[model samples]
Target: MNKKQKKMLIRIAITAVMLIALAFLPLTGIWRLLAYVAAYLVIGYDILRKAGIGIIHGRAFDECFLMAIATLGAFFLAVWTKSGDYVEGISVMLFYQIGELFQSYAVGKSRRNISALMDIRPDYANIEKDGKLEQVDPDEVAVGSIIVVQPGEKVPLDGVVVSGNSTLNTSALTGESLPRDVAEGNEIISGCINMSGVLKIRTTKAFGESTVSKILDLVENASSRKSRSEAFISRFARIYTPAVCIGAVLLGVAVPLLRMAFGADAQWVDWVYRALTFLVVSCPCALVISIPLSFFAGIGGASKEGILIKGSNYLEALAATKVVVFDKTGTLTQGVFEVTAVHHNELDADKVLEYAALAECASSHPISKSLQKAYGKPIDRSRVTNVEEISGHGITATVDGHSVAAGNAKLMKKLGIEYHDCHCVGTIIHMAVDGAYAGHIVISDIVKPHSAEAIARLKKSGVSKTVMLTGDARRVAEQVAGELGVDEVRSELLPGDKVAEVEKLLAEKSPKTNLAFVGDGINDAPVLTRADIGIAMGAMGSDAAIEAADVVLMDDDPLQIAKAIRISRKCIGIVRQNIVFSLIVKFACLALTAAGITNMWAAIFADVGVMILAVLNAIRALRVHNL
Candidate 1:
């Protein structure tokens, strides 16, 4: 614990013991009053000091001031009436102290949530110097510099793999709850754990500019951006605190005057005493504090699961997200290309794949590697020469003095080759030797198995529209889109075209409706930025998408995107409940107090009772993991 927190606990314990001693002791007169004074000071010293400071700063009245006056009024009345009831007044201060401690505990718990999320931050970064390992600040590490990450260490920054490979636990960044395989030339993001195998990462972003740091910054500042409900509480407290103070004053003065004018015998002391009680009951501390506390806890809980919501306003909006649009390839599918099928006529399947692999050996495209992987044998790079790459089609060249070709239909057609038709739903690559059609090899990007379930959960979570946008051909995009049960499909879109589609959806939104776009995080950055809510699959997401998105899903799972929305919906629901519940009780209690049907004791119950209830309710935000 911090020094201040420890000190407060010590003071609170001493005050509790002293108050009990005063009540139980046989000592009377000076000693008993002195004990009462000690109890008051122990439990209320902070309140008194704060009230004094607030007064000096020209804020005439505050919760602290109201509390001090009300408790003192109880003490004076006890003295006037010759009753041993000063304990009631002092107990108010004691309970106020307990309440303060309770608040501190709750705040500390929420702060711990933020700390735990940031525990993913790495303490050291490895740098290579003269063939030796050197430790340095991540900030001093430049892009393209090689950094070594050991097993079980948090990735210090975003980078591409230059050497080695590992299974990275990206649960902290994306809520995927799984370890992903990383290899040479693969991109790795910050805030993920290097689960196994050592890796040499070529840094692509500075320490401060990394995805993890940006997430930390956003989560830290989320509470400062108040939701509409929270803002209302602030305005309500400002109006209510002062208005109650004025009412208390008028009650203490006007009642006595009215009795005197009527020549009726009435105890002015009783009325003034009650007025002080009214002020204590109307402090508004609980309403002002607990409402925001709920949202703070909610945001904290989301952060723990690798969902970084930018602000309470966005959190509230997420609960209301009606339509969710997703990009197909990197978002719903395993972005890594894999050879799914091999088709060949007049030749063996392995040979067709071997020729295709040789044709694409020198090219760096994912499809090339996919076909190369299907061969499952090392290529004779010596024979694979004259590798001519044709843009917008495929790769071509003379391999072993044979005119080998492999690519989409466009490429085969360009070579004046006749390609056989195929029924499979995928990219059809045709091969030919010396201008004669050999056969066609079909390759498809398979969807992630979890995509269907992810969509199902979004429906359960209250999303009405589930749309998919992709640059893939209509047949390919639709084939995958159908399996996922997507509500709508828009295929064959460039990055600019995706932005235009997002704008069109936004324009078509009903009042109070919001649109969210999920993407591979690079090509879809503009659309992510343009939507009502930009949610990036940060892990496997492009750097540009991470910057533009308001909410980040660290592990590149479509399931977490839906999970995040549910979390936001739950948080916003709690916020609404607290707002309506607190206001109803507050307005009811204040009306009763004004009518004088409620006594000072009743006012205290009304105030303290409402606070304890609200506090318990606010802590519900921490239970988001269970939800």
Candidate 2:
């Protein structure tokens, strides 16, 4: 417990002991009243003070005002009747304080959970000066400067490893417990801990633009964007509190006057006591506190699992998503292209690939990179001469004093050379050596290991439709779609066409459901903004996509998409349950109290008991690991 909660606990204990002792003693009227008043002031002084301040500030229609009025009215009724029964008023305030203390403790526990998730903030960066290492603020390091990260130190900035190799612990950033291995020339992000060896890094971004900083900014501002349910509760409490207060006054005066008009005894004391009971039963504390707490705990829990939801509003929307749209490259498939086959070669397969890799060595295209990767050897550019790059076709060069050509079918047709067309679902690169038809190599992007399973999980989680949007060829797109079990496929689309497709899907779906678009490229930014919810892969995704997205998957796993939806559905379910349960109990108690069927003790349960149960249910949103 925090210091304030500790103090409140002490006060509650003292008040309970005093009330019990006064009940046992045989004191007379004045002494008994003074003892109960002393106990009431000890437990409820702050509540009375806050009610007085609200009245002075013209905001008297709050829970504090209701509580203060009810307890004070009960005390006045007891003294006027000379009943010496002050226990009812003191017990009401005592139980209310107990509920407030429980709320404080719950909120504190949630803050601690969020604080643990935010422990990735680095304290310092190690920079070399005068042949010695000096620790400085991470903000002071400039881009392109070299920073040293020793064993068990956090990488303070986004950079590329210039020297040494190490195993990095990325649990704080990705929520995965496995350590990632890094070597020279590998790109490393901030907020990862170096677990094995010393690493020298060349900084690529400053501290403010690092991944840790952006995530922290998103989490800190999440509460400002409230969900629809929270806003409704706020409006309801504003109107509900004052209306109940007025009803209590009418019951106190109107009922007694009606009795006097009927030529019966007024029984003013009995009627006024029922009014006080009604006020106590009608306080809206349960609905006001539990709804927002559920959302806050849900966000905190999701952060621990590497899902960064920008706001509670987005979380609510994600739970209602029935349509999921995906971008093919870097989302459902590994974006890197690889050489899959070599056929129809006059020389050896390795020989054809070597010539092609050498011919395309001067270019930096993705296809050329794939050929070079397949070659698995360093190229000597001096061996090639008379190089010519044919536009819309291929490259022609002399490799080791032999004519070498590498292109597609159009290039062979232009050269008047007969070539065999291979039937394959990939990008085909035909090769020609010395004006003779050589083998063609096939390059294709491999699908991710978990992409198909992710689609299945989404379907099981209540998603009705799944679509894949791609700028790739129709053949390749359809092949991937078939493998992934997507319900729809839109192929050979530009960025603008993707937006149009999303708009069409938006119009086609039911109005009550939502559509989410997922992508990981710079061109996907516009479509990401156009969809109902934008999910971006943060690890290798472009900066523009992340900026426009509503949800970010830190580990770039498609499986997290389903898990996020499940977490949100659980949270909204708890919110609805609390709203229904609190309202049912509150209205039921109000009816019994006004009819004089229950007393102040029952009103205490109607307010404090229900609030305590609702708060306990809200805390369940913080446990989401198994989900």
Candidate 3:
């Protein structure tokens, strides 16, 4: 337990001992009253002090004030009636303190899950200095500086591996159990564990701008952005507290006076006791605590599932999303090109593939890799020379003493080589060898395994429309859209055009519905920011994409979108249930107290009993695995 909880436990223990001692004592009159008062003060001194301070500050309508008024009035009634038994008053305060402690414990447990993120902050960074490793504060490490991450050490900053290889334990960041293998040229994010090997990393971002810092900032500031339900509860508490206090006063004073004027022997003490009971029942602790707790638990649960919701407001907004828009490249497709087919070859298909691979051997483009993979043989670099890369076209190089040009239709037109369009749906790389038309190879990106399933799940989850916007050609985009079964497709869109498309959809969508856009590129940042809910691919997405997104899918799984929405909906449902149930029960108990149909015991049930039940319901938000 924390120091605060320890202190509360000590107070509870002392109060319990004193109450037991008072029960065993044979004292009478003022002495017995003093012993009961001592027990009450031991447990409730803080509540009394807070009530006084609140009254002095003109904020006297909170639970502390109600509790203080109710318990002290009970004690006063006992003394004025010449009854020395103040046990009922002391029991009320003691039970109330016990309830408050229970609430503190519940909230602390919910917060502990989110607080696990604190372990991600690295204490030090190892930087290379003059061929020796020097440990420095993470804040002191500069961008572009080389940092060495040892085995079992946390990656202190986001960077690319310059040397060495290792399997990274990304469970803390991604919530995935499988360790990720990384070699030279792989980019690694901060907060992951370097599991097995020593890695020499060239830092790409400083400590403040790193992924870990951004995530921490997001989680810390999330509570300040309240959901609509939480806002309503705050407004309700402010107006409800003061209004109930006034009602209680009128019930105590005005009702008895008016009854006396009517010639009825209405007991003032009885009316005062009823008013105290009303005050206790009117306390709004259940709604005040549980609403925010439910949302907090939902966000914590989402984080554990590798979905980062930036705020409770966004978590609530996610539940209203009826239209989900997607970017084609990196979002739905694998974004890795592979050779699909070859046609119109004058020579053997192997010879044409060999020629293209040789011409593009020195290049690092996806298309080049596809060609080299199809060739299935290493190129003799000595046989190739005089390589020239034509921007937006392709390349020209000398392969085995023959001049070979591999490019698009534009490149063939530039070379004056008459070439036939492949009429294929995939990207066609046209080729010419020794000024003769050769075969073309078809390359295309593979759709993600979960893309179709995710779209179907979103539809099942009540998403009204699924749309895709892409910079790819119409044929390619349409093929992907058809395969994924999206409702609409907008192709050949630039980054600015994507933002416009999202805005257009935003305007055209139902007024009650929200538009969510998912993308994983730096160019998609603007659109991500423009959408109502921006979801980013956390694992392979760019820093800009992650920064602008409101929701992040840590493993880059599209299905998590539906899971996130379900979690939010469940949390909001719980909030509404708590609000309606608590208010109804409280109002009913308040009416009963005013009519003399209920007493202090029922008042305790209305206040503390409802709060306990609401807290239990709020804890259900953490159970998101089944959802």
Q: List ranges where model 1 is wrong by over 4 Å.
A: 1-3, 24-35, 80-84, 126-135, 142-148, 160-167, 181-187, 194-202, 540-542, 597-599
Report the lDDT tens digits of candidate 1 across residue range 89-207: 77787777767777778888888987888887778899878988888888888888999998988899999999998998877665557678999989888888998999999998998
Evaluated at residue 179, the lDDT of candidate 2 is: 91
Highest TM-score against the true fold, candidate: 2
Worst 10 contiguous positions by lDDT, candidate 3: 537-546
Computed on alpha carbons, the lDDT of every model, listed in order, comes to: 0.80, 0.91, 0.88
Worst 10 contiguous positions by lDDT, candidate 2: 537-546
Q: For residue 463, give model 3's deviation from the true position in Å.
A: 0.8
Model 1 residue 277 CA deviation in Å: 1.8
Residue pairs in clash, model 2:
none
Clashes of each: 4, 0, 0
Global CA lDDT computed for model 2: 0.91
> Model 1, 94: alpha-carbon shift in Å?
0.5
Q: Give the TM-scores of the predictions, in the order they appear.
A: 0.92, 0.96, 0.95
13-62: candidate 3 lDDT, tens digit per residue: 99888878877889998888888888889889999999999999998889
